[model samples]
Each structure stands twice: as structure tokens, then as C-alpha cells.
Target: MTEQNRLKQIIEAALLAAGKPLSLDEMIGLFAESEQPEKKRLREVLAELTEDYDGRGIEVTEVGSGFRIQVRAEFSPWVSKLWVERPPKYSRALLETLALIAYRQPITRGEIEDIRGVSVSTNIIKTLTEREWVRVVGHRDVPGKPALYATTKEFLDYFNLKSLNELPTLAEIRDLDSINRELELQDPDKVSDEQPDGDAKAAEGGEEDPETQQDGDDAIPTDEIDTESTVKESEAEAEPEVFAESSDETDSFDHLDSAETPSAEDDTSDQQIDVDTEPMDDAEQPETEPPAVALSDEEQTPLKTEIDE
Candidate 1:
């Protein structure tokens, strides 16, 4: 074989056997000092290898770390069967946290929580660190000295990404449903119902609010109404009744006060009282309803005369 053919075979063997990506320097180190090829010639060989894999099941890919030989994504379904263990299932929360770290590096956990509107779980961070997909680049100068996180080359390798630049833009990320479909980041538990959640619900299929329901052909779902605003509106409607009841109570109390006080317009309304009037003591028996009494013959004399007349 020619020297060029030998060099290609050596590099290919190193890549396949390494079980990980190998940089150009590492690939070149596979040869003796005198037989090592220059980077330019190595690039040519890699190009040739890529072309050789154009229609093949496996291909040579250059990710952020270096070049690797991996099975093409098209053959994953079959290639995946070689492994007995089921792929680890990632929750949507974990995927989202990862995406944030990838897109916005040197970001703090608090900042991630701010964007996600929920606190990041400890397990999510631990998993990323354990996987070597993320690392603390530095600490922020702010209070508490929060550790700033950034994605590592292994993350790119796992995703088959060339670099951070190859990641989807924020605008593309905004189309979460489509991106989720492309990335297969759906959480089986959450998506079992097949209904979208969070920001995706509004963006995908224009789904109606869960609060509202459709009855028939005549009913069309209205826009998602704010529950808080609805509650405020109901309170506003109930305010007048509350005010009227309070006003009535106030007026009744005022009437009672007025009755107890002497009034110039109604002098005859005051009851006749003697100077020897005495207030009842606590020991006195409480007043009870008057009892009926039978009248004597003299008391009935006036009633008998009136009836006879």
C-alpha cells in the first residue's frame, strides 16, 4: 500500500477504536515522528473519508472537541437495539435547563430560574455536571458569588454539534413545539395526554384555555381570559350591594340615636316621667311579657252596659 493509504488506515483505526473523538494532534500522534502527516494532508484524508461515507450508514463527524466516527442519525433506530439498557429519559425541565446553559453561557442558576420562571432542581444540575456536559466557568462578582455555568465540549459531542454557533437561535428556540419535535425532548409523562403546556400551548395549534370549554357547533372558544381579571371584575360587580347594606346599617343606627335624643320637630314623642324615676339594678328581675288577668264584676259592669246599649 502507498504511504497515503497507510496513513488513512491508521487514522481511521484510531478513530474507530478510541470510542471517543480524536483531535488532529492525537490522530497525528498515532504515527512515528518521521511518518506523521501535516494538518492540511490530514484534512484532505478526512474529507475523503467523509465522501466515502456519503451514502453509508456510518460517517466521520467533526464536533466541538474533535473528529469522531459515529453511526448516522438515520440508522439510530436499528443501531439503538445493540444496547440492552433503555436510553435515559430526560424531563422537559432538564432539557430546558440544558438549552438555556448552551445558549446563554456563563449564566448563574438564579438567572436560569429567572428565565424559566421556576427554581432549578438540584438533580438537574448534578446530572449535567456528572455527565460533564456543563461546568462552572467562574463566579459572578455579585453577592453570594454565584457560580457561572457554561456548556462543555462533551455537550457538543453528545449533541453532535460543531460549536455553540451551531446551536439554534433564540428565535428558533421560541418555536418550542417544532424544536421539541426536532430534538425529541418531549417528556413522556407530561406529554402522555398529547396536549401542549406552558408557552407552547399558545404557540402550537392555538389551543383553547383549559378554563374554557366547547359545547357544540355553535360554541367557539374565546381568547384565554385572565382569571385574576375575572375575579376582580366579579368583586367590582359585588361592591354596590356591599355598600348599600353598610349604608342601610348606618341609617338604622342613626335612626335609633335620633329616637333617644330630644327633637324640636316632635316634642309630643317624649314619654311622661316623674322626678322620682329610678334605673333598674342588676339584681332586679328582668322585665317579662305581661300576663293576662281576669276582671271582677265591677270592671265588667262598664263592658255589660255598653253591649246592652
Candidate 2:
């Protein structure tokens, strides 16, 4: 059989076996013939097959785990018209949260909380997340490490919006005063230079404030110790004079005081040990001359010395 025909038969059998949407990867694994099967061609074939079934009683939708051939939702009204049972209605909080997300996309939970004036319900988010309508787009570089959530492409399909920009403006969002607008003000995509853990490289080797830099990835170390002895030694050499000269309360360099540094006593001990071994290091060190003449005042008075001379 031709590749297309064989693939059609394979997909038809896979559909029968899966009884649900089959993912692109799943199909590739099943029909991947040789080393690196032609995935692009396969995708094209799948698209063609999906198009072939478009006008029929069924539709192909990418949902949950994979793509599936399911009855057209547009026909749900005609099919279920007799029974007339409505789909479950979402609660007010869920709808409000969804609307906020749908309108001001890529928003963080803290922003949502701020707008709602109440702590966000995890279950509301969980339900939206489970529905696959909302997804983590990015995070805010803020104190709490809040995740930025946005409506997905499936959200667009479900809500019948073409794109995020097509959503009604905040000025028009039904009777809810705009707060997520501020939430949308912070865009992770715009701040692409920052780290996932919120580590941002400041201008001229300056450090980004920790409060302003992290989004709370638990795998990252919250505090990084300067383990290099050189750093401690340099700070030890610098601190007394550094503090004496600076009076700025805002200076973060004051962190040097909190950090462990080599003290003067430690340096004195090191110097005493070094002095005992200075002879060995003489080649590497400057040499000093020993005293050659000694004066004894009792040996000769000034008048007696003059007469004798």
C-alpha cells in the first residue's frame, strides 16, 4: 500500500485502539518506519486525513492528552436537543477568574488576588488548569515567585476567540473595575533577560535585588554562599577602611559586615608564623640590613676622648 493509504489504515486502527485523541508523538512512534521517520510528511498526512473527515458527522480536536475524532460540538445542540440537559455551570469565582485571565492574559496569582481582594482559591485555578484553558505562560519577578497564567489556544477554541487581542478591553469587561490591567503591566516575555529564578544581571556588574528578581522555583538555592577564600581575604583587607569612609545606609556592601571575614588577629598570627620562616621566603621578599655599630657611653667621656685623640 502507498504510505498515505498505509498511514490512514494505521491511524484508523490507532483511533480504534486509543478510543481517544492520539498525540503526535504516539503516532510517530507507531508509524515511524526507519531511523527518523518523515514526521513533517506524517503531519501533513494527518492534516489531510483530518480535513477529509471535516464535513462528515465527526470533528478532530486536540484535547487533554491527544487528538481524537469526536462528534462535532456544533451539532451537540441538534443531537442533545431532545434531552435538553445543560452543561455544568462554573461558579461565580471561577468565571470571574477565567474572565480576568481571558482578558488580561499572562497574569500572576498575586495580581489576581490583588484584584479580587481575597486569597485566590487553588481549586478555581485547578479547575481552569484541568480544563486546559489556562496555562503557565511565565512568572513575575516579585517577592512571592508568582506564576503567570494565560489562556491557551484551546481556550481560544473553546471561547471562540481568534486571539488574546480580540478579547474585550478592560474598559469594557462587565462591571468589574480593572485590576488585572496592572497585572498585565509586568510581562515576562518583555523581560527576557532575567533568569527563571529571577536572577537579573544589572548594569555594570550590579546585582538585582533578590526581592525583585525571583519567582520561587524551589529547586534553586535561596542563598548562595561566597565559598572562595579570596573573597573573604579581600573583604578582610577592605572592611575597616571601607566602613570608615562610607556612611551610606542604603549601601548593600554593608553585607560585608555580616559575611565572615579574616580578622586582624588571624592576620597577626599568620604574620608571626611567616616571620619565623622569613629566611626561606627571602628570595621572594625584600632583604633588610642588620645593625653593625654599637655605642657604649661609659667607655669614653667626651673630654677624655678629645685629649686621647
- Candidate 1 per-residue lDDT, tens place, 62-114, comes to 99889999998989999899999998999888888898788678899999887
Full-model lDDT, candidate 1: 0.84
lDDT of 2 by residue, 24-79 (tens): 78887884367334668667767777888878988665554566666677787788
Error of 1 at 71 (Å): 1.1
* Candidate 1 least-lDDT 10 residues: 267-276
In Å, residue 248's CA in model 2 sits off its true spot by: 79
Identify the runs in model 2 with alpha carbons over 4 angstroms from their true place. Answer: 16-20, 32-36, 61-66, 78-86, 116-119, 129-139, 151-309
Name the top lDDT candidate.
1
Off by over 4 Å in 1: 173-309
For every model shown, what is its TM-score relative to the native structure?
Answer: 0.58, 0.43
RMSD of every candidate to native, in Å, equals 21.0, 32.1
Query: Best candidate, TM-score-wise?
Result: 1
Clashing pairs in 2: 21-67, 21-68, 145-215, 198-213
